[model samples]
Target: MSMAGDGREPLPHGPDPEVNHSSIGSTSPERDPLTSLMEIRGSLMVFATVMASVTYRAGLNPPGGFWTDNIDGHKAGTPVFQDVYCTRYKIFHYFNTSSFMMSLFILLFAIKASINNSDITKIMLHLTVLMDVITLIVSYIVGAYEDFQSSTYALVLMLMVFIYLVLEATTLIVRLCKAIRQMAYVLAKI
Candidate 1:
């Protein structure tokens, strides 16, 4: 068989017998940790912005509309849903407000950190983001409580995912700490 004289590199037909195929793409530079952190920060910012907007809208225009007149102890402009389903409404309101506040805090801290290059505030940013997500989920579940079965399923799934994330985060933190300590010791020996 004759090889084509095209002015292009030949594609790999198969793994070369004399080459280590596993390391073929390993020569590229590793991603910088700072870049990864910045990416995560950007994502958190976007999520916070979205959650804030949604919760703000929900707060302004609650489900079931508002009471039009101050009659029978129901204040005008108060949510009718609150008067009807008091407990559920309170849960939803509290969670929604909490989510909104948390998102606002995340946004504030993210912006401040970015402007000032503050590493200390990043910890709070992470916690705020987590809380915002949790409250948002709780708010959704409460707001949609008319369907009990679906709410139950969502609650179960949310709890499972939260537990899994916590466990994985803990494991990752431990491994990272170990790696850093080992690297420090190695550098010390050199």
Candidate 2:
């Protein structure tokens, strides 16, 4: 694509920014992937925190499981909301909780990678992908234990998480490739 009006040759870094000023500051020549990744990580962190809380909390106090614990015990009667069968199924609460914790640690590494642009970022990226795979397995295991409806929901949510991690990995790879190509061009020019 022609980048300039005259079409002589596009600058290695693309067109000059006549006057650039934004909240993110000027886009560095490197086109650092971290800048965008930071925003995604921030949003994901908040979401994962809430999801984790709900995952563990819902296991203990599900909306469907709402019931008043009768201090009077069986002497009184079965509570109005107590379902003997509903409470039988146990959700794999730990999986989601652990997934949440892992996500946070990954976020920390993501932030570090974003800011520092070091080799450690690659390790963290691979870990993030691995965690996603583990979470998917956990969801299937939970499905084996949970009720049909709940199991479906859990699988769907885990699928979403898996897709998100994969997309992030792909984005980082593409951005890194672009940056490397630009750098190679610059080095050749020098």
Candidate 3:
């Protein structure tokens, strides 16, 4: 007959017929966000592993292959592409190595995040993933295309992706700022 201890008065009819008590505090296993995110992290780790392998292979066996013999002052082990297209090869290697390093960093942070679930690890995972994507795109653009026309197409694609990513990041930042401002306003009112 008394009111609920920490809440509103008891329902007039003893209990609300519409209330679903079983679902109030229990979360469904299938729809849990942490589980979903963990699955996604696993997939990301696999992707990063593949990317690392690919970049490493690309570094070893470039598009133009390698010098077979020590001839014309070119070492047998040196990349032929590096000799033929010095500038392009330098740019390609730089981006490729960057992508490889980023992939490793992403894998490391993702694993750490999976284990610890700390905010710093989460932030690092996001940042490394972002940088890895960017560097991978750049490496492909610089290394994959054989001609100017193909490179042009890749450049256009890169530009579109870059713009979309920038817009998404800007929107996220704006929303975060708005949420902080709203929270401050609410606290001030209190």
Candidate 4:
């Protein structure tokens, strides 16, 4: 017999003999990337929905007597609601809402990309969502509290929100730049 065929050497065996173990438990299901992405997207969507509703209610109905005169007989010129800056406030509020909606869309897109195993896109989407959250919080604080200009406490809160907005936006921009670089690298590799 030829050594290459019928004369081949037998396979080596371990010290212990193998035994059937079908009764043993199997491993748990692996973590699905889509599941994690969907969870994050769902959380972001819920937050956006709540913020949108609150913004709409505040814009449309407002509160009873939002422009009422003080008991000290000082008619504050129709309050902050009637001030010229009210237009600016409304514009900013609209921007905040639009940004949040856009971020939600980006998050959905990112989820799809993540399902396809794209990391850069997912990071960019997360950064976008974070930016939207920061903007929403700042705008909501500014829009909800008209006493920011009068009350020291409110003014401090406003300042803090403003600072947060700036910081978050800066960080998001940096992340976006990094993501773009990563995408370029991935594309070049392909």
Q: Top model by TM-score, which number?
A: 3
Candidate numbers, best lDDT first, in rank order: 3, 1, 4, 2
Tens-digit lDDT string for candidate 2 (73-119): 43233322234333333333445555656666655654454364443
lDDT of 1 by residue, 1-190 (tens): 3368866776667778787666553432454435435656777778889999999999898878899999899999989989999999999999999999988887776565434322333444555566677778778777766777757777788788777656655665566566667778989999
Ranked by TM-score, top first: 3, 1, 4, 2
Off by over 4 Å in 1: 1-34, 71-73, 113-124, 150-155, 162-190
Sliding window of 10 residues with minimal summed lDDT for model 3: 114-123
Q: Against the hidden reference, what TM-scores do the models get?
A: 0.60, 0.39, 0.64, 0.54
Each model's Cα RMSD: 6.5, 11.3, 10.5, 12.7
- What's the lDDT for all of these models? 0.73, 0.54, 0.74, 0.59
- The candidate, 2 or 3, that scores higher on lDDT is 3
Could you tell me how far off, in angstroms, the CA of residue 177 lies in candidate 4 after the best superposition? 1.8
Model 1 score (lDDT) = 0.73
Model 4 regions lying over 4 Å from their true place: 1-31, 62-86, 89-93, 103-117, 145-149
- Report the C-alpha lDDT of model 4 over 161-190, residue by residue, as the tens digit: 768767876776787688789879989999
Candidate 2 RMSD to the real structure:
11.3
3 or 4, which is superior by TM-score?
A: 3
